[model samples]
Target chain A: MLKKGGFVLSAGLVVLLMVALIYQIKNKYYLDILFMTFFWASLAAAWNISGGYAGQFSLGHAAYVGIGAYSTALLYINFHVSPWIGMVVGGLFSALLALFIGVITVKVRGPFYTLITIAVAELLYISAIQLKELTHGSEGVSLPFKPGWVNMTFRERETYVVLALLFVALIYFITKTMERRRIGYYLIAIRENEDAARALGVPVKEMKLLATVLSAFLTAVGGAIYAMYIMFIEPDSVLSFAFSIQPALMSIIGGLGTSLGPLIGSFVLSPLDMFLRESFSHINGLNLLIYGFLLVLFVLFWPEGLWPNAVRVYRKWRSGGVETKS
Target chain B: MLLQLTVSGILLGGIYALIAVGLTLIFGVMRIVNFTHGDLVMLGMYLTYLLYKGFGLDPYISLFIVPLALFLIGVLIQKLVVQRVVGRPHEVQIFATVGLSMMLSNAVLAYFKGDYRSVQTTYSTDTIQIGPVFLGVPQIVAFGISAVITLVLFLFLKFTYTGKAIRATTQNRISATLMGIDVRRVYTMTFAIGSALAGIAAVLLMPLYPTYPSIGEAYLLIAFVVVVLGGLGSIPGALVGALIIGVVETVSAYYLGSGWKQAAYFVIFILVLIMRPQGLFGQRGAEQL
Candidate 1:
């Protein structure tokens, strides 16, 4: 009961922080950072469903992201459809693709699955680049700037922050709901040991497919928002391996398989990434070097991530009299 | 033209075989897929390039020095980094190697500035024509050297006492250890040998592909596809897989436009993966075993 209360309080505090952030939207840079951070957090959280919960290490998540971005952008550009409607269509399309990939590849466990995902992502990226007439190839596609509710555009940054926050909150609540359900338990069981889970009567393949489809859908939604926010979408920018790596990095660094991990990871890493972009533009690849080194260090030393440690601290404070050992 | 493409594909497959062998060697021995295997090859290429460009040594000659140096580095890395995380969870292994790959590639980028560099050898322009196809002398030389090295390595694994022990360890580490085969030593040696082969492949490929930090990613993806398509932990499988990939890629580039070549190969790669998850040469139940 106490743990549940603490969780609710912590979530409330996060909401309060988000509300405070909206008041600071006068600063466009700060608002942009918040939007990007939440965008990444949403994607990372979505990634954790399949990668962390289901334990399928997919390195090609950018495929779904690209699919969502391009699908919605194309609809908006060509058919004059509202982005709101396009987002749903794009998400479902990406989810279908994920389901297809999951059905074929999930039978193979471990590194083989990872290899297949990488291959699939690479193949998709190459196809997108080659199909220049449809995707605009390397040149990318641009959405016109129109101010309206249906278009999801605003002259001020506050609107974006509110929308992104809503997304983050929706995803967070969905994941929380999932964690309480039988599906989440099945995913965790499969993640721990597929054979054991199968023996326990869990439909491993179906559960994994569900996770992948849901993950793809959420990721696609995030991608759609991102395209709208940036007002431009390109194959290289959307489908690159670097973009695929981001969610993994964020999820792993923040805390895998936990509700708060993606949020924590985004808060910690996104700012550093922004800083690197700002400071090391001239250094070519030094920032990537630092990023890679940090990932290695985190893997070696703190695989449980920062949130677990923070949880311990919070628990200790709540105990009131004596600090408990983590 | 067809005959030429076939010959060139075969020669290119030789180099691919060499690179994939290193990756398979480590997998065969340790049952751990080294994600950084491609980066190690990239490092080998850079080391070979530096030796030639800075010290005025021929790339072929530097091959002897580079592999030995890389072997030592590999041994050290295995002992210090890889060994520490050997028995941990799967995520740890993936993250460690993935992290290592990222670090190595980015470090190279920081140092080399992403320039495409190739060893300017005298034989670079020299080509020999046979029938309809003209083949570069350097590529032919690389093919021959790679074949010779692969043959020698095969002989060593088949004949040498230590080589037999490595193979035994690869098949069953616990049984090998129970039989007093010193599995630790086998792992170290396997890592060194695998890295050494990567080093050799780098030198052989440097004359053709040019050296760049991100070049590893391009080859890494291909090597990974070859490794998977061939079956993990199978050397001969790597060779066959490489040949198939090389032929497919070359043919696609010839028939389809160059732009569609990658797409065509990737389609084939995904189709094969979906159809035959265990690969053509991979032993059934070997993954679980």
Candidate 2:
């Protein structure tokens, strides 16, 4: 119980720090970066529920993002529906899509499921490009700003940052709740051994489907918010392989299956990504190379992720300098 | 037209079979999918291009040099990197290869600047007159070379002592170790041969398709689809699976719009995966997560 309290206290401190930094950073550019980081953190947390916690290892999460972005964008463009309503619709649609994909792929485990997810995302990407009439193809779509609460837009970056922080907090709470529940135990069980879980009378398929649907729904909400933030959406930008890779990278690099993993990962890696992109834009593909190299390095040297290492250190410090197992 | 589509599809299928066979070989022998298989092919193409452009060598002749080079690279990478994580978690293996792939591709991009480079062979423009269709000589040569290589590989696997050891390792690693076969040597050899085959395929197909750093992505996707459809650890199944995909892609591209060609193949791929998880010619008990 004290451990749990400590965890909550640390989380609260981090949130307070984020709020302080938002006000401290006067530059709009830095605020933009913070907002983007929080946004990605929220999505990465969503990805962690299915990928990190449930061990699904989905490689096509961009499909959900694209579906949410496009669905919301289309409704807003054609019917003039407020983004608030469209966001829910988009999330529901993505959830349904996830349900469909999960039903088909839940029987197969491991890399097979990962590959199918990639294929599904690729198919959606291609369709988005080919179906020019609806999607505008490669040209993409831009959202009209209503400059009000209904549109979820404000003139200042601070507002966006606050909203993103709220979203991240909500997602973190949900994940924490799930982690303490029976579903979390079942997910971890299935992750470790599917056959064993099934033999033990776990509803493996249903649990997996539920996890996937939740993942997709939350990811879609993130996408909806992203669309509102960017005020633009495109197939290539929204559904690219890189977008899919980011969540996985964040979850893995932070600490898979842990509540704080995705958040920590995004907090660290998003800044690196932004820095690399800005610095290496002239170097063609160097950014991706660096990203991949970092992933490899993390896998080799720190597979449990940065958060685990931090936790270990924290435990050691709290125990009055007791030597810990490596 | 249908006949023409069928013939073209068959020819393209032969190339797909050759590409996928290497992937299957690596997976079959070591249970490791060399995700960089396509990048090795890209390296092969670049090597061939340089040999032809600088040394005035024919692509056929450069094939010898490229495969040998890629074999060395494969051997070195396997010994240095892959060996370190032989029995580690799947994520480690995946990241290692994915890292190698990214590094190689980006290095190529930095060097080659994303230019579409192709070998300009004298016979590149030549074509054979088929019934209501034209078959390019380069493609015909690629198909013939693929067939010959496949046959040689099959023969080698069937007859040689080392080949039998590889097959043994593929079937049961512990049993092969028990039988006194060195599994490490088999892994190194498997990676080398697989990479060498990719090199050969690259040289064979260079005249027909443009080469670039990003070109590997196209082949990687196709190889992955074929490997899965072929069943991960089955060489013959890879060939048959490749043929199916190749034929499907060809016919679809010919009949439908080019944009929808990939979609059609992907649809078929998904359908096959759902309907028949075990690919054609794959053993019943070989399916793994």
Candidate 3:
């Protein structure tokens, strides 16, 4: 984590980069790519809270995201409640719902736990589809696209990017703080060995639930922002298994449980996803095929993920360990 | 109507049982939940689709060929990918198969373009009427095939030396190794056997259902429910669990809307987890709390 002064410096540098990036974006597409990178970075960090820090491999985060997205979208479309308020309600609602699920499956661990998480996500997806009057029966809901600050919609794409960057930065600070505090230690202890941690009076259930709530709330907030940015929402589009899996995939690829991992992962992967979308538009499944191959390769060989592994290699090379060893 | 649903559920249950048995076998022996087990099932279905499409090979005939081929694939997967994640954390193991699942399904999507495909056969629409109930011919055939294969598998595990070795290894990996059993080979073999069972299931299911890449996601959920409902590692348990799920699915779909069918089983799955994580047939000590 950046120290207090380093944090300020990094913040300033990020602001500078933001200005340069905004100035450099000549068209909507590049702006979109930048918007998506920060957008994905925020979501991945939200996932890292529960999956990475708390050590619960939740493959069903789309449930919370969908809940959040739908809560804000539906309220805005139907009731005309400002999404700013809707986002908070949605985030809090998702947290409560996650708590209910946690009550049911908190004692469960391992693959069984993963299965339950998936089941819950699928349950919500089905619910979203079935509740046609509310969710529109897969027809999806869309905002009015009213260009106003209250609606969270903006005339300028740069505003979205700036908002996304702020989201990422906010979640990053929370993660960094939690990682150094008692909550983070308790979570890691529970993750490393729940039984041992419980024996040591770590309050495993409460800690796990707390981490899950925070994670789910942040993810929902991102979902709300995403809905505003995209101005459209659907069950399959938002709550699909792929949406659920992507966060897990990103955290794993970047370095599961690390503060910088998700940021680094999204910074690397979002561009690749965009590039694939650009170049492989004609191809059917090439993008996912490549992602799968890359994921499997990483799981087998580079389980430490990308960023840390790169850091290790760089440090070794700089210290001349390679030459000495050779 | 009740009889019809019961009959159909059991028939469909046979297919579910076949898939779940393979999944439970892998989980039982290796303690690695093969999330890709359903993908293997999907792959098997595609293989059948391709064979029937290209060579005019009957799916029934392909059943013999498919399982053998799938066995080889399963063995390779266990050796190359699954083995590496065996002793690792749950996250690694889950993601490893999750990645494989993504890879296999997406590869199919890329190549097949997500069009739902089905084989045309004389018996595809044929059904037999018996005492106010109708049974689809292909469904009967699938049920028959699943039962025969399951019986054969049960006998193999009961009597055959290799099958017994697999069972012993499942019971205690280190002890089985200490007793000079080739534990590694046994794991590989179990995985192969499991995959073969999934292949047989896919072949049986092809006549009744259409093939698509993401179809695995549907069956994978069923397999999970069945694996947990039936005790992990117990073949009979998987069979029993599959039948229960099949009946529950058809009944709920009949009474409730079709969209809510999955939610019904998911409720049962969660209930089972909370009330009895050991499952209906699972021994008390089988699962770690």
| DockQ, all candidates in order | 0.66, 0.60, 0.73
Tens digits of per-residue lDDT for model 2, B158-209: 9999999999998889999999999999999988998898888888888877
Off by over 4 Å in 3: A318-326, B285-289
* Chain A TM-score, prediction 3: 0.94
Error of 1 at A177 (Å): 0.7
A161-279: candidate 3 lDDT, tens digit per residue: 98999899889989987987999999989888989999999999999999888999999999899889899899988898867888888888998888999898889888998999799
Over B218-278, each residue of candidate 1 has an lDDT whose tens digit, in order, gives: 7776787787789878888998988877877777789887777667666766776777766
Q: Using Cα atoms with residue i matched to residue i, what is each candidate's TM-score against the true structure?
A: 0.95, 0.95, 0.97
Query: Which one wins on TM-score?
Result: 3
Give the fraction of true interface contacts kept by model 1: 0.67
Per-residue lDDT of candidate 3, residues B43-95 (tens digit): 99999999999999999999889999899999999988998988788888888
Q: What is the lDDT of residue A266 in candidate 3?
A: 88
A-chain TM-score of every model: 0.93, 0.93, 0.94
For candidate 1, what is the DockQ? 0.66
Name the best candidate (by lDDT): 3
For model 1, residues A1-326, the per-residue Cα lDDT tens digits are 44767876887788778778697668788788888888889989999889989988888899888888998899999999899988899899989989888978755777767767887888888888888999988899999999889898777778877788889888898888799899889999998989999999999999999999999999898989889899888887889887677788888889888888988898888888878877888777776677778777887899888888788779888997467886
Query: In model 1, which runs have C-alpha deviations exceeding 4 angstroms?
Result: A2-17, A316-326
Over A34-130, each residue of candidate 2 has an lDDT whose tens digit, in order, gives: 8889988998999999998788888789999998889889999999888889989999999998998998885576666777888899899999999
Residue pairs of candidate 1 with colliding backbone atoms: none
Evaluated on chain B only, candidate 1 has a TM-score of: 0.95
Clashing pairs in 2: none
Candidates sorted on TM-score, descending: 3, 1, 2
